[model samples]
Target: MGQGRLPARLGLACCLLLLLLGGSGGLGSRGMPRGPWEEEQGPVAEGGPWGRARYEAVKKHLRAVGALSKQYWQYLACKVWQEGCEEEEEEEEEKESSPSPGLEADLNEQLHGQHLAKEVVVRAVQGFLQSPQPQKALVLSFHGWSGTGKNFVARMLASHLYRHGLKSKCVRVFISLFHFPYHKYVDSYKAQLKKQISETVQLCKQSLFIFDEAEKLHFSLLDAIKPFMGRYDNKGQVDYRRSIFLFLSNLGGNTINEVALDFWRAGRAREEISMEFLEQRLRLELLEPAENSYAHSHLLEENLIDFFVPFLPLEYHHVKLCARDAFLARGLPYTEAALDEVARMMVFVPKEEKLFSAQGCKSVSQRINYFLP
Candidate 1:
């Protein structure tokens, strides 16, 4: 018999039902609100011509960001609205008057541009949550040496998404430090890593997997994710959209000299260091084949990792460039002098050889603070 056609109303009802029943267990009790990160009182200006311009820019960016948030909510509602169960109306009505939970410090005004990267990360995360693909993308972020952006990004992203109407049911965001190379107990690292991936895969189809200090993941674990990184499907339909893997490494570790020296000392003869090691390890671990090399041979040559696909490493320059565009879209402008300064700043500088490390969004933000007013 042919499948029964669902009426428009019935279809919307079903969507709601699936949303409520499919992932309700994980829905945060506090629930998500709309416009998670739109600045209150809109965008503020410090005053004067420069300040006024900056204010306008901030407002423009805020509007762009806000629009994206609204689009996301509507998209989600449309997807689940049709499938909504009978009780959805009642549940929504109950929530209508409910005051939102208290704001997080990061969500508050003080932090502002300090959290740009977090904002980018969260939006990407929300995108993954609403994705149609079965396997979500994983994000891996690496902070500056001994830097604190690890938990900050995770917490901020979650809070930001929550404000935009994505509860735990729709999105799962986790960020943790690197405890590898030395764990209190044997197999603890691997076990926890594997369990986290499993949970992410089960809870949300489009997973956002991140490794803060991706470079620090164990060699064995690195070897395991190559197969899982690219598009694949059990039924052989070639599905690559399921997962998002982000590795936020300082591509040029501590100092070029130091990084090169370490590689040099290891007898890993190469004039330049490449993020390729991390990439190769991912392919070996997750992908089925590597240039048709033997399984043992590939494993022997590759590094062992504790987890699969610990954030595919992208150059700091590339990340910053992308972030700059994102920031500009949000209404921030770079004056000629400012642009020149940014171009120079974006260049990679070793810790020792450099007085500055174009700290991507953070650095640009500081520059804005100084130049704006």
Candidate 2:
């Protein structure tokens, strides 16, 4: 070896021997390497060894990793190691974000009457979600009277689509009067609404936004939503194609009720009141309204709304069914006679046929207080 290199190599070897000798050697009581707990509990040897295990232990204690759920801990581990985390995360998101396969069954069981709503909502949602790359977000405008299952069906959709239902961060419900009461704050509401939509879509790819009393929403607020609902998917921008926006309104209740009454008067089944019969009329009714209304908004003018789902007014039989459900839900025992009493207590319309319930089972549950002893 060269004289200069020989001395440098010898110096490194000597340093290694010195550290081994000065620190822990092969296993003796004092020379043995310390464990995680011992390092924390025992007196500090400032320049001592701190291995991966000790750091991991410190992380566990400091982060309260033990208190986390198994799924969360698995996620944390997967996040750090990145072994199959993408697949697991995607799978979990799909389960949480996608509409429930049981939605049809839920509609059948929970929702009474309104065959049009049941069929349209289920078919439209399923078809929209199945599309690989949808052109625009699924826009469903539900038109009907109060207690006609608009809000109920909205809740059902949210519950089925997300793990946390209406409470999900990915889901938002804006009641026009509650969220934005004053017409004076329209400008501020528009900005806030747009920001909320952008942030929500960024956080969750498949989000659900339900606008209750949608008919009362200011024209500016609806215009604010135009950009998000329009077919505009940039390369690295917020893609709203996978999202769903639902508008619940009682704007066309009269037209829908008239048709239902006409069908009843002609001895036709409510089921036979076809979508063709009501959809055209409902669309016209909503479109031919006053200026600055839902019809005048960009959403309708551009025809961005995919489907106009109409909820038919509930019948006395339907109201009775609702009472039955309420009774069952409350675990209260009731007879068919009791159900009829509750149904009859609700006000019916047309004054002569008294065919449909005016309130449409709106207060059927609270009305149960009548029979309580």
Candidate 3:
């Protein structure tokens, strides 16, 4: 009985030992638990530490793939929308840049008296439109007496160059007396002026800046614009080359008329009076100081202006032409007698000679009503 009991106990111990060995080395080819029940149930059980870690790693990988796919689709959608938006913006810009048919005809018909002035304006505008990347700003200085079509030509240019005409967002007109009244505060004014110009040019590369009554502006104020008007080696923050700067003043009116009158007295045709003659004399007059004149300004001394376009004084025939156009604009009867009467109403200078229109059809609109009614 004792021997049989001993064998049973020994057998029981051996069974226990075998069970421990099998539990320790029951790994599959991939080092996971291996058994029919374990394979079916999976290595990661719901409550165990190893089970939770394995489950979380699989979830994180799936989440990463989903995020990547979402980002890819969003990028593709944004690219498609951006391309369409860019095409629309380009088309709109092209349409705005083009000139209107009526604008061309009006400019040709309304801007009379000075044939050279018309040619210069037309050529400059054409050049500006045709250029893809201008190296310098188009700085045009219109010098003439009152009502000699200086302002009229500028208005016509603004109308043709921009879609909304003078009211366009890219067009900025600064009057000397109105915009910059405090000449005593030169430093503050200069800083403000530069800031406005820099900001405007940054916003729109093809901007138009009109300086009206420029002669009345301080000489220092005009000098502030020298850098923008001239060419530069480094273009800096804003490329002002594509912009247009127009200065309208009565600075060289007398010089222009004297040249014209001299040519007339010499019995030479108006066409013979070359631009070289006008430019040289005008430059001299502008550089020399005179009472109530812009001659002292560095703008002339530095020769920063690209074109010094002279609006020649209007003759009797030119005023008559202006009257006829005004009548037509008002939808009134066009009569030769009415046109002649309008021309006769204007006050001409040099009573002895009575050569050209002193007012240059400036009061034509007002005088037209006198003849019409």
Higher-scoring candidate on lDDT, 2 or 3:
2
Candidate 1 contains a number of clashing pairs equal to 57
- Candidate 2 residue pairs in backbone clash: none
TM-score of each: 0.34, 0.76, 0.72
Candidate 1 segments exceeding 4 Å error:
1-181, 223-241, 248-334, 341-362
Best by TM-score, which number?
2
Clashes by residue pair, model 3: none
lDDT of 3 by residue, 255-290 (tens): 999888888889987767778778888888887767
Q: For residues 224-303, what per-residue lDDT tens digits would candidate 1 score against the true structure?
A: 44545533456643333455554444433233324434654587643344544444433434334422222332332433
Q: List the candidate 2 regions with Cα displacement exceeding 4 Å.
A: 1-95, 233-236
Decoy 2 TM-score against native: 0.76
List the candidates ranked by lDDT, beginning with the highest: 2, 3, 1
